[model samples]
Target: MENNNNLNNSEKKGIGRRDLIKGLAAVPVLGALAFSTSKKNAYDQNLKNSILRELNIDASTPPPTGPMAGDPVRLGIIGYGIRGKQLVKAAGFMARSEKEKLQKSALENPNDTRLKDFMEQENLNVRFTGVCDLFDVRAEEALDTVTTDDNKPKRFGTYQEMLASPDIDGVIIATPDHWHAPISIDAARAGKHVYVEKCMTHKVNETYELYDAVKTSGIVFQVGHQHRQTQSFVTARDVLRKNVLGHVSLVQACTNRNSDNGAWQYNIHEKASPETIDWQQFLGNAPQIPFNKEHFFRWRKWWEYGSGLAGDLLTHDYDRINCLFRMGIPKSATASGGIYTHKDGRDVPDVYHVVMEYPDFQMGTSQEKGKEKGFTFMYSATLGNQFGGRNTLLMGHDATLELLGNTITVHADPRSTRYKEMIKDKMIDPEVPLYSYNPMANGVDGVTSATAKYFANKGLLFTYRNGKRVDSTHLHIREWLSGIRNGTKVSCGIEEGFEEAISAHMTTLAFKLGRKIEWDADAKKIINVTEEEINQCDFITI
Candidate 1:
């Protein structure tokens, strides 16, 4: 580690070699070292830290990934809205307007390292050959963003038209939830690799169709659960493997966003009209509604274009846990909640609660055999402060894990068998974290807006690798491109995506139908729920 640090010019701040090695003297593992509160009480912090130290991951070890030196992978982008723009930027391309905004911000405050971080982002050999967006303003802006001196990106009238073109090798599907499966299926059939956004499918049938299409296509497919690249999460997997948390019987993940932006009340652009936006193409298989700006701008608020909190936000929480431990589709799901907060004319629920049961699953127990078997995964969310809560908690018999964004903290249970001696001797406090992994311990990186803060906290924005700040989405895209270029395996492939989509869709159905939803893994169908019953759903039709 010292040898590597000596090779760099330690001139800059924040990400400098000397600055990065600030907190990693005693621990070395992906820059994430164990840390506790600075306020030292009566007992010494070192003694408390020594007894409960965990996360034995080798920080010096880098991921075995291939070099990106091949010919650029020709890519097409569909849907260039908020998420779409962010996705492209993560792939080493930022819009001129956003770049200028960052430049102004950096000029005002030296601490705003976003522009510097972006300029230093490693280039993944990929090119945008085509773009398909319903909005003309966004499409033209996307063309400007992707065009280069050697390669000029073309704007396609529709995704099918883009897929039919031989100029493209793969597609990035950032469209609404309803179009995720359709566009992905089209790309798969067109023999193009895909990097689609999360909540992979809007409906149950679409989920199956997508799974089948990707399987038959023989093309590289990757889902956009970018946090799969998070360093703390990678370490958390190791922690779970060592049974540091014992048998996690219950996991609770919450979302308590109060702001209008956090609640999906996005601003409607003034120039957004039928002339500027292709309203019909945007609708796709969704309900034929009279052109409404609210439905178009803030599509997440409606069930037609989005799947409410279950699909939009909960998928992140679900996939986060799923990635940590490959706990596939749950045996049963029970949901209950309603539109308690944002009472605008949207049909989808604002406050949501879902309980998914895994009857025959286990997370490797430290107790007697067969003692700890099944577990319940609970998801709760609200648009306001009434039912507000923070932190995604993994409650185990021996300890509890708090996954708040990029930081991971594990607390020993008071009656834990694994840490009973440490608790008895007062070497470890039940209230205090047994250990924690904070990658930002050396310095701080800040984000504005409640929504962006929420994502950054959840490790969706950026993470550090070998002391350098890196975007998780960029790593995700690079993994897809690597799979396309070098035949390497992708983390969030078809099977993982299937589980995420099915789990989310089941929870959504349970909430809508007011009953327990069960999945038959053997038959690969929703048990007790018929095709006709699923089709009759108003939200599904919408």
Candidate 2:
């Protein structure tokens, strides 16, 4: 997990003033050179502003309360792709509102002029700091949206350059999957906290590297598994934990979409040109190939940059499932699927299913321990978007819980005849006291009857548990900020992020190898591979 920052110093030795001038000098000769040049300038200005904001030396005198309260932590965003842009909008809204509130409070009391001026300065306080991308245009575009009047962050043509900046307190990485690990590792080594997008790393082994670096760097880290923070999911977790559904054994989850665009057939922008896209940066550690707009914009379609639907969709399910069950990495994982619909030359599967097994565990010492039944997770995703519509079912011995959209329904196990009879008896039990006169006598039967009454009154034939759900989006972001401020471990820390990534990789392997692969969880290696077979396919890195 630790990074070698010193290596960055060595990398800087090669790019000098002449090299920079020569690079810029050749730009005009290239197609759409003017656009590239302007984009580059815009990125540079953005980086400069970001630097000022990081130091709290920008015009905004009094920073709004963040994790550090009086001393707000500066966040430098590295990519301005879709997710990065979204983060900027979110952070911008937060900063602007805080500034407005401070201004209003200052006006209420003339003695607050100092705070007023600070608010004015802070209004334009955030610095874009540093931007780097293989495509000069993407870096430029990211810079343009980040800069403000008082702050200008430095712009780097490459992520390596961004990490070299001393002003950055933390970096928000929304790069392609291939670039996620390297850039994050480099930033961590440079002593900057990291907030990486979902499916943290592309390679399985890279997960271990990230986990080690974060542990040693003493910097906060958060993974973009926002679903974990959702209120509905939280409510689901509570109901499951409370065993309202009895002994849970099987859990099924899925995400289905039925549109050309939904299936990642993204609309190719007519404006996309060499000047605005960073082709090289997008390529990162993936095998070098010709600059293709399709690959650059719709990366999830290819195996080089992404693990297809598994990483994009399945990983989210894995993270949430892990959270709900308090399970570690899956004991074993197997998958099957293919490109059944999309005829494009994409390397990823469109329809896929993966099954994870968690064998039973025992509680207490060996002599006194009792075995606890384990559970199976059946996960699936389809391109057709069938209308039985998408949903997750957590089935237990007592009842089954269904989560679809915002509504959650719990049903008594259809196979439980005995429980059904008991429920029916409770409904007719006139002897059942609304307020028990003899509390001691109203024992097991009273508790069971009361449970049935609670569900019956809600118009639910089966027992149901409901409540106001948590807003996962806010919770996930808050968790990240909190981790940064307190140096605490994040819910989706590096280890979990890595495991999720690894699980996705395994799915891809299963499809390609056309066989069920057994993973040695302890050794963290593919168990069934022979030496000769190993040389044929590159092993998955975390």
Candidate 3:
């Protein structure tokens, strides 16, 4: 309880920029020059110091140890909205100096009890190069928060200007769903690594464009499915790998929150207006509409910008299961639900459900090669009630695994084969969890907003590592930056993002067409639509 209190306080106070760059001052120019001799290494200490100096990071601060402590990466932020601000905060965690990090370690001398097992997760340190947003207020706010001492981020009138900037090594895209693919493609083509927020892409065709761009540019592209870093999902993946759960036959996931924010009724900024916001830029490829404060603030409520529950909520729940089980594209999907809760002028549904069929895939090597048993993946979401909270459950013959934020619980199945002997010997009981993994030894309760709590409980917002809570957003960003520096694939790379995008699109199509949609993996197209029917539909090309 005491540790959890410190956790909350640390979040509220935030880590200062001094703590972030203090350690870099100790690295000498000759030492950096010596390390730059390796052809495979991208770390240029002098160049990093110059960038830090420009950012107003004091050069006199002591240098601490880490992979890229002396060499920081230049980052430009695109779309400085809600999620973008949160991502920026997470990036700051990655920016903390190793010396400052060690000073807070649990073993050394924790200022709080929660510091145990906490070490600053390293990134190729990050320096904000610029910020881009359609809203002047949002852009200015983000620029101020992300900048250091006397350094101010260059304000870009458009995303293209930011992407074209030579000072930026990469860009983080947290724009609306529609702009993800286009901005990502542009960033890649501009020779910049990309960390793009989820929903992957808006139009189905653009998904392929973004995928191809990442491939062509050979850039490290990471989808913002930060849940990939959640310890519960990581443990669940191991459980699946161990074959202790037997063959998972059915998976259930849900998103339920009863709040104005959860329903996409975000508060409009007081400064929002035609003059303050570039409404034309925000419209992008969407149908042109006159500037309206509600439309600009509550964009997610409409289908023109957001993909409804399927893309916004379902994609999050589905991606975690996909990561755990390695479930690629589904065979077919059927969706049902409606805008039963929010009666506002929204085109998307407030309550939704989808069922996707998966072909028999090998869950274990022990299973017969020819034997196959198909399974169903289910996703349900509701904005009217916050009854059960959000979670993912995978049921198997041997046991059922329940995944919550930082917890993974496995309960025995009565008629299990693999666990039958243990059950009979009284080593395990069907009513009790056979195994449970909880990363948060000191629990956090009611420290955040209801909507934030909803996401946190679902392992989407933050995760625990080595008994200490760490922002998954930071971990995901670190992974992307590390991959770029090392020339390796990221956790949620282009192919993974493509798979997620296509799967979500299938659900969206199913809801839109009011019919089951089947995937023709070989042909790479939706099978149920005819050439004429495709033209008749207006949402997006399949």
Index of the highest-lDDT prediction: 1
Per-residue accuracy of model 1 over 140-175 as CA lDDT, tens digit each: 999999999889999999899999999999999998
Give a tens-digit lDDT track for model 3, residues 291-382. 88887888888878888888788888888888887778898999999989899889899999999998755676224564336679999889
Cα lDDT computed for each candidate against the true fold: 0.85, 0.61, 0.77
Deviating ranges (above 4 Å) for candidate 2 = 1-68, 93-127, 134-137, 361-372, 386-388, 405-407, 417-421, 426-474, 530-542
Per-candidate RMSD, Å? 11.7, 29.1, 19.0
**Model 2 per-residue lDDT tens digits across residues 1-542:** 12323344554545555556766987667757777888989886665454223222111111112453444456677776656755554444223444565578667755444233232222322345666555555556666656667667677767676677777777888877777888788888888888888778877667678878888998778787765544345555665554455566778977566677657776676767766676666776777787798998788888777777788878877776776676666666788887888878987888889887776521111111232366778888776564344467766665667764334566655443324554454421223211111111222211123322222221111111122222233345556666767555567787778778777766666666776666777787767655345333333322
Could you tell me the C-alpha RMSD of candidate 3 in Å?
Answer: 19.0
Q: Estimate the lDDT of model 1.
A: 0.85
List the candidate 1 regions with Cα displacement exceeding 4 Å: 1-64, 386-389, 538-542
What ranges in model 3 sit over 4 Å off? 1-66, 93-124, 365-372, 442-446, 531-542
457: Cα error in model 2, Å: 27
Candidate that would win on TM-score: 1
Better candidate by TM-score, 1 or 2: 1
TM-scores of the candidates are 0.89, 0.69, 0.80
* C-alpha lDDT of candidate 2 relative to the true structure: 0.61
